[model samples]
Target: MNVTLTLALFIAAWALLDYLKPQFVANLEDNILSFLLAIITLVSFGQVVARYGFNTGWSAALEFNMLAFSWLILFGMSYGIRTRLHLGVDILLQKVGPQTAKMLGIFGGLLGAFYALIILDGAVLSIVGVDKEGGAITYFAKMYKVGIGVEEMKYPAFVQEMFGLKRPHVQRWVVLLILPISLGLLAYRCLQASWHIYTGQCGSLIAGHEAESLVEENRGALKD
Candidate 1:
């Protein structure tokens, strides 16, 4: 469907931006996450203040918080990988020689990249709701065809009128748009890490030996 094609184009455009202006891409990601957190925090705080002070609160506050949290989590995957925050047990790497560990680390990174691709394809196929991939209509297409909007999350009246939509609520498909995008970012980070390891730029995958480093940093303090 056109919706899928458009989203795919957006993904490609994002990849291009990532290639050409990596710092801008990084700033964009950080800003998005920060904005989401700000929204969640402000909405939650307003709800609490209203409820306690005036015995009235926004009914949609909880739902809005949930939405913001979901977006944060979906988009945070790549950030975690980019910062090497996603750690794993490196027992085998520890036991092996440095060269062997390096290879194993590269293999692990490739595995992560493969896993991201698998998830991305599976999500697209599941959302498309067809036996096969090509020539299939996506769930977003179907939702648009029916023009169903989400519950408790409303668009501004002007937006509803401008779009000529029957309902004021935001669409479900729009909220879920982050899924594929997040997975794409995940795959890119994995491959990037793999390449770095292969080129002797990064030491290994999965932020190895973080606990050891933390312990070392605080060792003298504990004794004191």
Candidate 2:
């Protein structure tokens, strides 16, 4: 598997262990995953420092890292909403029996699947647009002025123009791929949730009705 899929599977495994085992081994695995994530983040920071230099200091680094982190959270929440893991009123859901709850869950998953499919289509179109543009935003005249009199040595004048403008080439392309990939993942998660719901495993696959009941029951006992 690619590194991204491997990390995604590792996260699912951690989520599984957290739900099923929730014991020492799972806790240890969680800690190991956390450590690996931290190490990878640090390595990413090192790469940035090596490429961008430390001349910009901590504030710039913090701003850059915060932007990346914000994207991560934004994608995660997008996926969470598709999976119905975003907050909702569960009191009514729990008041109904498992059959009704499961049906509602299935309905929710179907709705999410429809939404994810729309996002997936949009993502594909966006990727196609990027491909058509060759990942560059160049006007025809802007593309014409960059050559130093070398025949057939034309280039998109962005690099030169950015240098002229004293602006940085902040390679936002890597981040551009984020949305499509996240949408694809979100679609997969919705399908997974749908499968679990159909197979009567949604209640166990996620901490849903059972968790709400436990919390409510605990709160009532405390009141008593």
Candidate 3:
């Protein structure tokens, strides 16, 4: 849920920036969130020290890893979308006339959909594996039942369960639950990009310099 919120915030911020400021948006369009996350990791280290004194539980490492992955994917995808660089065909499409370009775009989208399905399949398998293995980190294995709702410590509930205790128990890979949905969104975007190309419409959601280039292209096409 924390990862979900982090991703949501990043996307919302990305959308807002795309709406409000288009030119200067390139700064965050690349790696701002990564740097912010690095700062968060540094701060979390202090919190880890404060919470467990010298212990600094290993669970924090797992928790932080999840956070890092969540932010990286969220913001990285935002950057990719903004730049029109999400495994797309830009140069080849540009060389062709509008009709053929549009056809190729639709083909690209269908291809992307197939690839997304493969990724979704892998994600489902990985999630199932997590559930089957009932994996718990070393910290949880060591002090599982010892602490539960004691303070706002960041550890999986399964860790508590392993130690003969109970806490909030969602599925093991609950953090990754939204991944399928995000992949679905990626597929949808591919379809949308294809549609925009076919219809000779620059997509409303295309952002940053990509949006500017799209607008300029449309204008130039209208002149021709």
CA lDDT of 218 in candidate 1?
100
Residue range 16-81, candidate 2, lDDT tens digits: 664587576435634644654575498577757866885443334444455556556546644454
For every model shown, the clashing-pair count is: 0, 0, 0
- TM-score (C-alpha) between model 2 and the true structure: 0.47
Instruction: List where candidate 1 sits over 4 angstroms from the true fold.
Output: 2-8, 123-146, 214-224
| Ranking, TM-score, top scorer first | 1, 2, 3
Q: Candidate 1 — worst ten consecutive residues by lDDT sum?
A: 130-139
TM-scores vs. true structure, each candidate: 0.81, 0.47, 0.46
Q: How does candidate 3 score on lDDT?
A: 0.53
By TM-score, the best candidate is 1
lDDT of 3 by residue, 40-129 (tens): 677677767866797555544555556556756754653554356555326665567867756765776666655554454434335335
lDDT at position 137, candidate 3: 24
Against the reference, the lDDT scores of all candidates come to: 0.77, 0.52, 0.53
**Candidate 2: clashing pairs of residues:** none
User: Taking the tens digit of each residue's C-alpha lDDT, what string does model 1 give over 65-181?
Assistant: 887898899789878877777778888888999899888888878888777765655454454474434221244466657767778989888888888978778887677677667
Clashing pairs in 3: none
